[model samples]
Target: MVSIAIIGRPNVGKSTLFNRLVGKRLALVDDQPGVTRDRRPGEGRLMDLSFEIVDTAGLENAHSESLSGRMREQTEEAIRIADLSLFMVDVKSGITPEDQDFAEVARRAGGKIVLVANKAEARDSDIGYLDAYALGLGDPVAISAEHGEGMGDLRDALVEALGIEVFDRDAVASDEAIVDVPVPEDDDTPLPYDETKPLRMAIVGRPNAGKSTLVNRMLGEERMLTGPEAGITRDSISVEWEWRGRHFKIFDTAGLRRKARVQEKLEKLSVADALRALKFAEVVVIVLDVTIPFERQDLTIVDLIAREGRAPVIAFNKWDIAEDRQELAKELREKTERLLPQVRGIRTVMISGETGEGLDRLMKAVVDTHRTWNSRVTTAKLNQWLERTIAHHPPPAVSGRRVTIKFMTQVKTRPPTFMLSTTRPEAIGASYSRYIINGLRDSFDLKGVPIRLGLRKPRNPYAAKKKRSS
Candidate 1:
């Protein structure tokens, strides 16, 4: 497949164009320049043309050891590997010396380059668009990636540059057909493990918790920019990998800080992006610093995951340098149980993101937690267990009338929601509900995932007759 790299200096709307081509808001966009620091890849399509597209950081003039310099290296690498390069320029701002320098850099890379003049919708952008020709990269493809303008011309330019024969028309048609298939709404059965689908997992935690380092270790390369700086990652970056023949799409998200401390607009955007990743993820790995495990913010994050109905696996990171390993482990386990009784018996793995220690255990725990999250109990087994549980310690009476839960059925999985028909739904107190939930957890081996139990009163058949008689 043909791969295209989108590269430019800061605030050129490169990410906007990349998102437009990929047809998803996969990259973070902001008025702030240099918001993107890593190279992000996605499958892109324009009309019938399909190719792999890479969004790169803005080219900056910095020393090789600086962060901006590192970002430039990533962009250069993307240009080196891609079949083509989309050298984007901000037409509204006109061409600058930086643009001239980066144009030379792209040309030196020896790849087929397409100059894209973005933000062409602005009335004053005409001069800037004209100025793009001075860079000597051929006639620029004028486009407004933000407003979806001049896309047809861009497609024609790509075909002219790369040749139409490069794209697989049949494969693209098949993919479109597959996407048109509708999903069944009534299919509530537990989903069987399908090896063809990639498991979606998100690694999240407070700032500076080694989330990026952990992802780099897993990928066996420096795929993410990492250092002692807090909040190095601004976007929730997803990477595709295969572990033991199982496909996985791992998302490494930005660090989350306390709500009060998040005063910046960019930080809020990053936090919101991280939250979206958590919601869509099948399993979330909460990376906690081992030395100070289970802080208030950490607990809040875990609670948020539970409330979002996401399966969670706890990872105590930075274990390589810790002292008193056994004692620390014991204390952490106790804290996990006492502080997080909602997700009782949650799986916790001690890992070292820097050294690749305990990674297998963490992945296994994630898989197991996801399975448990999707698990369902048969109606017969659920009622039988309910009978035995109530027999042991029945529900307390309300207003001198016993509260009887007659039937129970699992409504859905993916957090495992259940419905219970009871004589009085509102009479069930918090303590009694906790009892039943704990019983269900222990009997069904449903641990580490949130279980939702809803109570409702059965409809009365004689309600109309009683009203008429009265």
Candidate 2:
């Protein structure tokens, strides 16, 4: 792993030592000086030295077509693809001239640098920690990174500049081997899908809806920091893809604007880091902007990804600069089935994140809405589709008595939750729970996701002997 990066210049806490070596407050730490303009990455650790850290942007010598020169070309492409850099500086602000011109641009972009010297718990940070040995890139490490103090001499200057056999960890845990698998104590079984796991997803929408230009057109690089700026992303980055062989991770967030124009505080920490990447997404694409597609803040971000149950996928993007493209894709698919009928058949597509057209039908509608949000049915096919959906229409007469529904099951699947067993779970209404969630999404093809039913009742075993004989 050994990646590193962190570098220097603006508000030198370098995202508070990159949220203290990735224990995650994942970037966007405002004391504002170019509140971090991009380059993120994570997975770090220190005591035992795990690696890959990143968190860049604040280097600025600006002017090559502004926006602080595309944030100093994303911190000089994270110090030419890191293998250790750190650099930092602000020893209570002493070593300036933009820290000797980004320490001679991280010593002409060659790697292994270190030299931290952060706020070293400021007692006038000892003449900027002895004026950081005149920007020569060596003996500094003196940190504080916001009071987590010298972090064991910045993990002994990154184990004396990347040695300790590049963090062995028992030869990488004996080159991986752990296979347990045996859990079907029958809750209607069905879990097995692991195509080598990964798929977390998350893109999201609203401001400048090309969600970081469709994540730089699905990582064909420039990784993320597009412009013509709307909210130039403010952090929720993630990124480790792979498609035709599965594995994902995605999460490019921050654009969601409405809560009264998100009255600052860095746009409310970039809309709480885009609702914590739409609640740790399991699938959520949204995107939109094909000339203002479904605005009302894009159906309130598709009803907040159907109240955070996730599995979404809508896309649209700039459809190569639209204009009656097949009658605006048939009036945006009849306004996405009349404004997203709670994700009914929701899987839109039509793209052009700056011309990579329909990104393979938006990742095949996000791997078929994450395989129907991890579907699972069989509790005897959910009681034979709840007895032909209650013989085509039952569960009605409430006070006059007919509300039965004695059982149903599937109590879980990423968005496939179920549970009925009713006699009168308060006469289950909301139009008979949308007719048993539209007959379990038309008898289990489960359409684009968000299902969850819930009810309950069947308890009266003589009501505890009629409450102890009244």
Candidate 3:
């Protein structure tokens, strides 16, 4: 792949430009300088030109063993491997001595460099843009990474530095190349069990519970920012990946906290984004620290997933450090059974995010749960089962009248929603509802999936006619 790296002194808008090019906030960005201390790589696209981009730590001069010096080594390494580098500078701050130092480093690295003067949205930045010429790199492309200004000039600079033919933006938009190909007609046939369709899964849990670490392990790379600090992730980022030839799209969501404890405005937004990810996901893996297995918030998160009609897999993470494996497993199983009985028989997998242990089993459980979530029960089989189930332990009487469930039909799948037509639907007790739902789970082998059971009294035609006459 064509390789490019972003290298600059501390707080020069390098991370912001990196995010702008990579199309997401994959790197952590804060007003605090030196937020990024590692080299992060991602696939990036500029219009139609695709390349691998690396976001490096802010460059600075320090003792080799020091943190800032270590960060500088990472940036130098990125420059060494890259075919081109975007040497970014903060125009508002002008060319500091550090900027000149990194510029000299970039020049000696022997890679094509594009000088990017960021924060040029303000008129006052003109002097800094001129100061960039003293570095003797090249004419600086002045732009604002935050406001997305002067991208055309930046694109032109990148094209020239990469030594590529000028890209025809209009040609990229036109469909002329595929005009001769016949369009396939749409058929009303239902799709068969196809693995080509991307499996949509979301990883979620409480803050500092190794949610991001587990995601990075599954991806086989550090795609998300992870540190000892809580709430490092603020946005829900979906990454596409393939395993064993099966395509999958996994969402790495921000850690969820109790609503009452969530006081920060940014934390509230992050929680909202995480919830949105859960709703869009077909299967959710609730990451729990084995030592602190089931906090009240973890159960709440699982309940939310169940109520949203999505399948759930309880992943006990950090298993490598847990004290007693057998005891912890028993406790976790018992807690899952007692607490999340609504999503009865949810699959639980033990994993270690650091050691990469039990990942295959976790993935297998995920795939299996997704299959169960999309399962369908035949109408005849459902009704037959319902008859036998009701016969064994009939619905209890309410005010001297027993509720009679006449029929049941599956309304949908993907969480397996069903509608039961019944006499005295309003009289159905919560206990009886749980009994029927448990029966459905047991009979259909629909483990690890949330089942939605709805009661409906058959629409009364006479009532509608009576109302019209009145």
What are the lDDT figures for the candidates, one per model? 0.89, 0.81, 0.81
How many Å off is the CA of 296 in candidate 1? 1.4
With candidate 3 superimposed using the best TM-score fit, by how many Å does residue 439's alpha carbon deviate from the native? Answer: 1.5
The sequence of per-residue lDDT tens digits that candidate 1 reaches over residues 266-352 is: 889899999988887888999999988878999999999999888999999999999999999999999899999999989999999
TM-score, per-candidate, Cα-based:
0.93, 0.37, 0.80
Put the candidates in TM-score order, highest first: 1, 3, 2
What local lDDT score does residue 16 receive in model 2, on the 0 to 100 scale? 81
Q: In lDDT terms, which candidate is top?
A: 1
Better by TM-score, candidate 2 or 1: 1
Model 3, residue 165: distance off in Å is: 5.2
Error of 1 at 22 (Å): 2.4
lDDT of 3 at 197: 64
- The sequence of per-residue lDDT tens digits that candidate 2 reaches over residues 50-101 is 7778888788777878778987897898889888888888888788898998
Winner of 1 and 3 under lDDT: 1
**Winner by TM-score between candidate 3 and candidate 1:** 1
